[model samples]
Target: MLVSRGQQSTLLNRVKIEGRGLHTGAPVAVTVNPAPPDSGFVFSRTDLPGKPSLKACPERVSETSRSTTLEDANCRIGTVEHFLAAAAVAELDNLYIEVQGPEMPIMDGSSQPIFSELEKGGRKKQEAPRLWRKIEEPVFVREGFASLVVLPEERFRVTFVFIGPPPIGHQVVDRERDWEELLPARTFGWLEEARELREKGLARGGGEDCALIFSSGEAAPPYRLPDEPVSHKVLDLLGDLALYRPILGHFIAVRSGHSLNNKMARKLKEGEAGSNARKMFADN
Candidate 1:
């Protein structure tokens, strides 16, 4: 018989932040605390009567608009990928996130706050061996004008293509996981999207200070990479990985969003059934 030794870790302490939800425009506060072994990542809405905690998983997904919303029928939580991404890349296997609102704080329209808080909280190795979902076959899904596919790989890889009206023209990014370089890419919105979102009472407070707002016939702000949209798309994908599955495969995304992300996550769940590879994961 063969056995594999792997590393698993979680945070040593808790981290907290306060801000407003990007779309809901609701003021909220969040605290990420360490959990017992195998707790994974769970969200507790303290604002609700019972402080219902919604665990991050595909099963909890109730909607996928501009952001991902997870609900348990009794309660709902929104816009959580960035913080989840921070925990994923840091390799935290367990966390307890208690929020005092319906959605998480936008926190600079990026995962910056999550990153900073994770670093300050520090990471500690656990006694348990890492449990990973080793991919054996291709799993995929499609949305309007977009698609997502994941194929077997030794490590995580994200491939995305950004295309639309000019300046926001066709762009592609494919890279193996590098959390440090990828984590800082901020979320963005076009003028048409911004205005419409506001008209609909969403993200009315989102501005240049928080997100990268791109308008027609105008140049983009100082960017770290030529195709930063695709990079940020990768960030979004990583955040969604908090579904607590190690997708040992490459994900190819084209004009995708939370909808496609949730779709692909569901498909991946089905494929993992009866996989020959060693699968280690917590209940998400």
Candidate 2:
């Protein structure tokens, strides 16, 4: 259950899961397979001809409306943040995830199921040392009311704050000792937004079990903890950023969604590139 320092790891066995996609509502089956060291997380379209694969990297992201989507000429996969977050928390550095449909299964709109599956698979260290991004300076991005800030640290940490109208008013969640609290936090939205997404042919699988609905006079879904909405946002943020190597820093996020999370990830990558360039110049 412990990842050795300076060692890479992957699942010891393969695990399969089946559920419905949050956006497409199509029933899908996914299998998590162990990959060689340094492979990173990859998604393969098993149902498609030739089984095209896409690397789960932030630069591969093509869309982030409602959910994060990865796209390439051969395939596109949507709603991947929850699954990715589970992988990140598990310290799974390499994996081959095969999916039978266009989107990842919602799994009650929480990361719990995916994390459980990974736990069942266990973990085994590889020969290579683990890779990670070490932050050297503060990197920050802001878009009006939403912002993400990353400051240098020796380990990963996150804090999230959210503000919304009515029932969802002002929630903040601090990172706990482990990621367990974040796993059960389900995706949520306003009743009006749900109706609009349904009209646009989205959120087809969302319901009382898969998501929390905030509407006057309507019963809310069972909250796993207080301020679960903000917890879920943090879940999404962690997932989106998991595309990069494990990052060493403290991330402070405010009202950020999938789009903003991905933007922060890109900025992190850019920062690394800049750091490398400066190092090379000094060496020369």
Best by lDDT: 2
Clashing pairs in 2: none
Candidate 2, residues 1-284, lDDT tens digits: the string is 11225788899999998999998888999999999988999999999999999998889899988899999999899999999999988888999999999999998889999899999999998998886777768889888899999887777788888997766779988773588768998888778888888999988888777887788656655678888899899899989999877877788998999888888888777677777777678779
- C-alpha TM-scores of all predictions: 0.91, 0.93
Against the reference, the lDDT scores of all candidates come to 0.77, 0.87
Q: After superposition, how far is residue 214 of candidate 1 from its true place, in Å?
A: 1.0
Give model 1's TM-score versus the native structure. 0.91
Global lDDT for candidate 2? 0.87
Task: Name the regions of candidate 2 deviating beyond 4 angstroms.
Answer: 1-5, 217-221, 279-284
Displacement of residue 188 (Cα, Å) in model 2 is: 0.3
Give the lDDT of residue 237 in candidate 1. 81
Candidate 2 clash total? 0
RMSD (CA, Å), candidate 2 to true, equals 2.9
Q: For each candidate, how many residue pairs have backbone atoms clashing (under 3 Å)?
A: 0, 0
